[model samples]
Target: MASTSTSATSKDSPEPSPDVRVWLGNRQAVEEVTDHERLAAMTDTELAQQGEPKVRRAIPMKKACTFLNIPGGTPLLEGVGTVVKAWPHMSDASAPAWVASTSGAYASLLAEHFGGVEVREPEDPDVMHGPYTTDTAAVAGETKGKG
Candidate 1:
């Protein structure tokens, strides 16, 4: 004969972990992103009243690299990645926009780091969902290629 017992353990229940908590907290600290102009058009003061920034600051490539863990051999080279500048009042309104750029072999690598959104062409101000802002990142400073 075999004996069996079943019981519910407190640990088995789904609970929010600290990482989830921290991510949510960070997300909240920034403005709510959207493609709706009517919503984004709210003034900076208005956004502040709502407890958010009209335009969220960009996330740096270095930080993004650490988050994604791509090797240097990748097209991104080293400092090749995007900085996302949140639009004020949803600049496009009907579309999301970000301006990202890089100088190195890895335009694709930069694109990959940013969830594979197509790299936008220069001379286009309306970047719908791409990296934004500029920083002087160079190849030499990047860590040697590694997975």
Candidate 2:
């Protein structure tokens, strides 16, 4: 009787790993991308040069506002409104880039790192939501009249 032994080698290929779905973002939205060509196109020079490339997606306004302890619904000044600025944290060596809107309402968000600069108010003053005002007088009158 002849005895045969088998050994696994490079020639015996292992099971392929699953393709990873990469997330990318621009000004509009976050999206999962699978195509290599699309990913390559989305990648910048800094990201492309790395051995293990990583992408940083922009965070949503609500999340950023929450993180910075600012009101989410704060209206931005026109022309300066809706623009998000991201820059490296100069004070902290380990910190990631800071992101904030260009609106004056959120100026405090970046005050520590950047010198407080005066941001212009919206051209149309009426564009912003007015301060909260309710018909409390009507409720008081109804209660008093009933009593």
Candidate 3:
């Protein structure tokens, strides 16, 4: 299954561009997907192009860095073994916790999904200290704290 994300704005495309749908693991997007039927017809190569993933706020991770698996859902990752700090989510944890932060794939996924994982800049220690949620604005014209 392809993971569709609309947060990615085309770098070269101009204003009011349509949202790009990306495949999270591949760290890429194929332009134009309005439904599952169309998306399902795309070839494997089309599904795996080098399109950019969206970055909100936080340090961009590198290929060599590591990440904690907080959400732990679909597309299971092969971790480095043993639970590390589940920071910004929990203190204590269980197995299969950390995974390679390859090409910022996992970091991008967490950022997009608000999956409770982050790679903050080491020099900037003040950005994240506790649980955080991205974008206070909710869907359907509803603000986070309001009805």
Candidate 4:
């Protein structure tokens, strides 16, 4: 049967793994990306075994966003009040925003809504419902940057 697990990221810097090493744009790390063009090239078994590069960072993704784009006062749902309390600075519509979901059309749409912004989150296989097994990942795993 399929199972799930979680683990804590070490406070130290990211450690190296066989997979490519870099940071993703979104600040949830994504889960079940399973469609990146690059990963498509890998054989089923290869892709399954090729888990994300192991990483370590003291701060969690949510904490990274605690101060980001936060409004000075309570946020308004709609109307001109929204104009005054928006994120990334209410005065700058061009300031920028980042979406954080599994890589796919939903994420794409969210980015497009923000003028094709992009993902700003990261995923921890240990925590975010994964550490996907070779069998479970036989055909997916294509997100880029940090996983």
Clash count, one per candidate: 9, 0, 0, 11
For model 4, the run of ten residues with the poorest summed lDDT: 134-143
> lDDT by residue for model 4 over 1-147, one digit each (tens)?
111111222456364211111111323222233345556566878868985333222323432221111121221122112222222221123423444433233334445556766544336433233222111111011212222
Per-residue accuracy of model 1 over 1-147 as CA lDDT, tens digit each: 111111222466563221100000011112233435645677878766775423343343321111112223332232243222221211222222222332222333445544654544433343222232221222333422111
Better of 1 and 4 by lDDT: 4
After superposition, the stretches of candidate 2 with alpha carbons farther than 4 Å from their true spots are 1-85, 89-105, 122-147
Kindly give the stretch of ten consecutive residues in candidate 2 with the minimal lDDT sum.
Answer: 138-147
lDDT of 2 by residue, 67-145 (tens): 1111222222221121222121111122212333324334433333334433223232221231211111111112110
TM-scores for all predictions: 0.25, 0.18, 0.18, 0.22
Scored by TM-score, the top model is 1
Q: At residue 137, what lDDT does model 4 achieve? A: 11
State how far residue 28 of model 2 sits from its true place (Å): 21
For residues 1-147, what per-residue lDDT tens digits would candidate 3 score against the true structure?
A: 122223334566554422221111111111221345545666777667833232222322221122222212213122111112122212112221222232244435444344443444322223222122221221222222110
